[model samples]
Target chain A: MSAWGMIKTIIFGGSTLAFFFILWFYNPFKHVEHYEVEKDVKAIIDNPWKKTESGKTIAEEGRELFVANCSSCHSLRYDGIYIMSVQTNPKWKNIEKTAGRPVYRYGKLYKDRFFVPKDVYEAFAHDDLQSLKASFGQVPPDLSTIYLARGEGYLYEFILNPQKVLPGTSMPQIFNPQFDPQAKEKVAKIVAYMKSVNTPPPQEQFKRTVMGVVVIGYFLLMGLLLWKYRQNLLKRLGYH
Target chain B: MGLISKFIDWIDERAHIREIYRTQMVEYKVPKNLTFPYVFGVLALVTFAIQIISGIVLLLYYKPSIADAFDSATYSIMGEIPFGWLFRHIHATGANFFMAIVYLHMFTGIYYNAYKKPRELVWIVGWLIYFVLILTALSGYLLPWGQLSYWGFIVTTEIPGSLAEAPIFKDFFKAVAETIVLWMKGGYVVTDVTLGRVFGSHVLIYPLILLALVGTHLYLVRAAGISNPDGIEYDKKKNPDKFVPFHPYITLKEGAYVMWYLAIFFFFVFFHISHFLPPDNFEPANPLKTPPHIAPEWYLLGYYEVFRSIPDKFWGFVAFNALLLLLLLLPFLDWSPLKSARRRPLFFILFLIFMFSSMALTILGTMPPTPQNAMLGLIFAALVFGFFLSLPIISIFEYGWYKMKTKGGQKE
Candidate 1:
């Protein structure tokens, strides 16, 4: 073989082997394990709320305030509504009991029945939606998952003065030092309530790890086979 | 004859398919000494295909609206759709890889002097394709409506506003810049309208332009033929032994390299997915709040640094554009008979410096514009321009030395 031909073979073989070794060496499962554990510990340490002067936890005070004030517009039962409907709604119950075959057939219907709020489930949901939109200029978003999406700091600022934080926002300034003396504490409590109700989505470590192994293995095998085939073909062509 | 052969013959007779095939692929000859770097063009095309396929798959679940775009991309697609995460990962990673491979491909072209003489159109078209690809990537980045996407869009689109600060024609330039910025954002600020416009451009407009450019680029490559590392053009009729048919020899080699590329690509897609996804992008876009440090994707960092290095916004914009224009005019700038840097030591060293300086600029681009970082950025940015500006002088001197050496050797 010529010098160039040998270099080609070496590069081809070396890169293929090196990439495969790198893929095998970096175990995604182990990384995911460390990532999730660290995240959980961080979350625990990062909890900001404290007990009030009255011995009430901030989250408890926030929950009471939320029920009195924000509950008129925003519902804290977003995910709960879905879970409750799945268990108690006759239509959903029938679909759930039918196992795989009917579930597949009723997939579209199942999706529709999945996430109905308490007010929507009760009566005149469409009318209620229009009225709510008419009143607020836009339908108020559920506060249940707001904490997960917007961090505590943003939630605090937004709840304290919606207009100040987001100019042109339809949300009214419900809590302020001018209107209420303990407005800062009230906003903090609201944020604490939001944080307490919402949990981040569970880490899919098992699925991701399995996928990483399978995908890496498949590519590694394909690469080796191609390398072998290429070498043989080049040899036969008298190029190697 | 087999039925397939008969059918092929019928098609060939009418369309002259055999002639086209013979001229284009089967009997087309390239230099025998072409090496590993040549495979990057093929890898780039493969990455393009991956992006297109995965991007289309992602579009199925991607909501272009600002309100739902984040959740649709993350919760709906990544969580709900089976192997949807894989497609999203591939699309995201493939975009970065596409830019990476294109940079390598461009470097390979430069190193081999593939942009010289008859291959200028090829380089020009390839550059246009690179430009469109960046635009497409930028537009696509905004589709997720994440924090980085939102802020990055704001920062990038507002770059044109610096034109208003130009010393001359202040009002006219200001009006034009403001209009352009407003038009790009679809309002005074980035919003739902901006998302819609970006989505339209990303999926429909930029891809169309890219495809057209890519087609022209490939045609130009075919017409010009591939340049080799030696930078010596060999006519097949004159020296048939020095050339090989591209069909099996080149295709087989490309296949091996492609497999290697895929292995590394999938490894990142599966294990190091976070490399493509910045943590800031995990959060949905909040127009009220801005990220502390907003930067473009890794590929655009060098240019971003060049923009930041100059304190004046207007001059920085000019410098940024000047760098791109200089790169495009590389063939015209360096007028030397010695095409290959291997034969030109000075050019090779300058090229290395240019490459390192740009890399340094890219690293600096990621950091906050501190005094030290800004100073380093300015230095590297100067080196980058210095390489281009000094190319012609160095090339002329090198040519003179080469001529003298050869003439002296003949006398001896």
Candidate 2:
């Protein structure tokens, strides 16, 4: 091969390697540690009402607080209301199993019924806040995604004083620790529960071993191809 | 009979597949001097194929309704489905690369003056492809229902509202613009109805149009034959060695480039998926609360800068589309006898300046809109406009000067 041709190929191959190496180091898809709520900050004055537990333990306590307080308005799970409705309704079994069927025919009604359990129907009344909607003219947003959309910091402040954080907002301050004892502990548990509900599953980081194998395999095949095409490549480059 | 041969014969008899392949793939001739820039044409097709396949997979999980669109796209596609992030990243980043490759192909064609004489139709079809592609990308941008996408649509659609302010036929013009914008959104505001219609147009209507245009473009390329890189017309009798068959020779060269291109593509997909993303898009759309700053994807920012720089809204709308109009008029406007910039010193310098100005304007568009920045934007916008406007006059002048200097001067 001409010196110029060899130089060009080396430059191209080296740049390609360098480019991918940069991507390997700077990858956005690398596993990112998600946000988690802090459960305990030591009270400066040793407040007697504090739980003084780790965040996960506090969230465990918060589950009961959330069901009693937040469940009347904000839903805990995504589509919890829909699932509750499906359990009580009787027409859940009519959906066809045929392939290529138009999906809208099942509508919102029948689709949820397919997944509802028979025991759930007998256990609870339809749990959605339909009456709240009748009075307010707006259904409250589901809280399944609250921790994700607004970080734990916002949730803590909003719970303490809704009017102070967001003026003219519909949400009222539901807890006053001074007026009601144990309100502070209950609020902490609810915040912890909100954080626990929506934390994403951790991503598997891209493996260097797998990439090394793929690159080595690719280059091996490429080297063989280059050897096979040496004559044709030279001829095409006008060396002949 | 062998099983493979039987299957091939069955399909081949029904479709005449081999005949089509032999004619289109095997016998086609490309210029021997074709280089990396030439490969972008096929690279564009490669990226576009990636987009369509990944897009189809995404559509299976994506809900078009307002309430569900954001959650469905984010939760189902990114959080729920297996390897869903991979598909979503490929589709999103593939769209950007498709436009990037198309831009490279278009600019390379311009630098070589490929639109001269016999290839005007190919050039026109390319512009049309670009137009459809912009609309497709814009419509697709809103499907995520994020703050940036919502605001970007609002700003772009409001450009039409400027038409109402025109002097002579102000009311009629305003009515027409409003009607078109409303038709696009299916309402006065960007809501679930807007999302549904935009999604429909993005996946269904625009692709159909783009497919037809691309078919015509490829047919024209085969008909006209690939242009010589140095801008000399191909003559078989003069040097038959200058042409090579597409299948093995050109195909092999392009295959290597495709490998390199895919490496770059995967680099963005893996590491820099957010390279084109505005951070504001992480927040869901809130009609009551507008983001502090708004901008488009980087590719369209140059024109967006021009639009924002103009204080007069009516003139800004006119100027925005007029830039595209200038591109459409390029073949006729450039009256130079010479075809390639390689032989033209003055034009090459000007082209460099034009490219720099365009890049600068794009960067400037992302900065806070201040008077000083706006002034710079206006200056760059004028330079870009002048570059297109002066093409014919400059070509004529330069060619005349060359002829005067050397009576025997001829383009090699």
Candidate 3:
């Protein structure tokens, strides 16, 4: 086969896709930036009075505080909830961190999910307080699973510098990076809330190791059934 | 005043390209029954486009000198340049995905009997592309000058060096490979020499070759058209001149499929980027240190696993390599009267085994590549050989016996 064929295919296919990208990415009319915020933040917005820690440990206290202070825009799940993307705001760099993600954990869900509060927040800014008190157009994300999306270091630093990390946003910088704000007062408390929201890794995932054998067993049964089914089909078709 | 006419003239001159794109492309109608296996070809194409475009942008900022090689790459991504990070991530991420899709596509070709005679060159060219991709990945990895990139270079290139005919040749080969290693240090050895070469290859040589090869692969694919599951060529013999131009038929079909694949690719690009690639690659390459585990690209994990599981070095190397080389002989080994797997009974089972073995080996390779992994590696390697290379022969033999028994021992 001619190697050029692959090249042409890519060139042709990619150029078409690039056209789509031009539409998807370069939407000037789209001024309202959307982002996927943290889950606990969303939970607080959905129902601030919803039970906190009603379960155990520091997580319970963290949830209560999170629902009370946060939850306006943040989501309770790992998927993205539209907040704000920096590309929308021409003056995003000029604003404070309040336009992006908030610092300090309002609840347990915000602790572990690293990228939302940092990576996502750092990438965009909020446009107005109407969006802010309402949690930007995007729901704040649940921090419980943030670390898995971003990383520990990124999350930790985000908690340290919410404003500097992401310039514009409604998320207030509760922790001071210069003096290293109260361990339990600012970042630590938020982290505790995030930790409280953490759930154990899925039990079914651990069973994947045996998934190979499980698949083989499934195939074995299916193969046998298939042979029988084929035989039946053959009979119906008057082949044999 | 004459832009439209000028465009018409341009099209007239490159009429073949226009015809190829507009009409000839749709001539060979690809089977609409293709499932997930069909997406790999499209995925491979996407990867090449990403590599080429990102590679071009990166080339603008990447420095080939020893002092700034790694930093230039770092800047291209995270620095002041516009969309540098996106380009870098896309290119970097594209490498991993390309290799994976290539392997998947190659396997799909084999399992579906798409590499029978006439399309032998297609498979061979694909294999060549595989080699190019490996080189591309090797050079691209070092662009970062990180610990993984550094050691990754040493471990990978060492394989070819070991096959050198003479000691002097071997030493020279190693030295030549290590020249960039020296320059990467900002010295000789691996410090700076390696990083410089890596960045140069990543930005300059590999991307150009990749572009050329992609064109060739596509041309042949379009010229030959997608191989039917029946392993029949799209020619007078099988098609019997009942051909339709590619303009609307296949183009529409491929276009529809392309959009579906794009939806999936975009989902991963935005939402699942981290899971597909490691974060450490984002940092600049460093030569002195090593990551917790030294592993090959996910595609090579199968052989790496086999290599680790075997006790003897010679046998390990042979077993590890045979896992891939095994496919080149499939055209002959496949003795099924019908080319389609639907009729070919036993060969299909063996194909699945070959696939599973490779996948299993990749997981094993992620672990430490050490002597203690002998049993696991040996078993998997044996399976790889049995499943990939020997399965067709085994199927031929088994079917021959069944045929004989059913025919009451008639020699004819």
Interface RMSD of every candidate?
7.9, 10.4, 18.4
lDDT of 2 by residue, B1-412 (tens): 6999999999999999999888777676677787566888999988888888999999998888876676666655664566676688788888878877787788778877888778889999999999999999999999888777888898878777788878788779978988977876678877667788899999999999999999999999888888876778877568778876676676666666666667667666655665554345656676877876677876798888998898888888889789999998898988787777766666776676676677677777767788998999999999999889889888888778767766766434
lDDT of 3 by residue, B1-412 (tens): 5999888878888765766555445444454334445667876886787777777887778766644554455433333355565566566557666775687688778767777655666776777788777777767766655455666776775553333323356667556545543443434356445566566666678677877877787788766667665444445447544443443433434454555544445444444455334545533343544665676666666766766576554455666566557666666666544454544557667666766666556555555555655566666677777765575676677677757766895432
Q: Which residue segments of model 3 deviate by more than 4 Å?
A: A1-240, B1-23, B26-36, B65-67, B159-188, B222-225, B232-245, B282-286, B332-337, B368-374, B398-412
Q: Is candidate 2 or candidate 3 better by TM-score?
A: 2
Worst 10 residues of 2 chain B by lDDT: B274-283
Candidate 3 chain B minimal-lDDT segment of 10 residues: B159-168
Candidate 1, clashing residue pairs?
Answer: none
Per-residue lDDT over A25-116 for candidate 3, one digit per residue giving the tens place of the 0 to 100 score = 44232232243435544443223223445544444455544444444444332222223333235554333333333222212233322223
Residue A130 lDDT, candidate 3, scale 0-100:
43
For all candidates in order, state the fraction of native interface contacts they contain: 0.27, 0.01, 0.00
> Residue B157 of model 2: what lDDT?
81
Question: Which of candidates 1 and 3 is the stronger one according to TM-score?
Answer: 1
The CAPRI classification for model 1 reads as incorrect
| Per-residue lDDT over A9-62 for candidate 2, one digit per residue giving the tens place of the 0 to 100 score | 475446434433433234342333343334452131112223455534555566
- Quote the TM-score that chain A achieves in each candidate: 0.47, 0.45, 0.32
Instruction: Report the Cα lDDT for residue B276, model 2.
Output: 50
Give lDDT per model, in order: 0.73, 0.69, 0.54
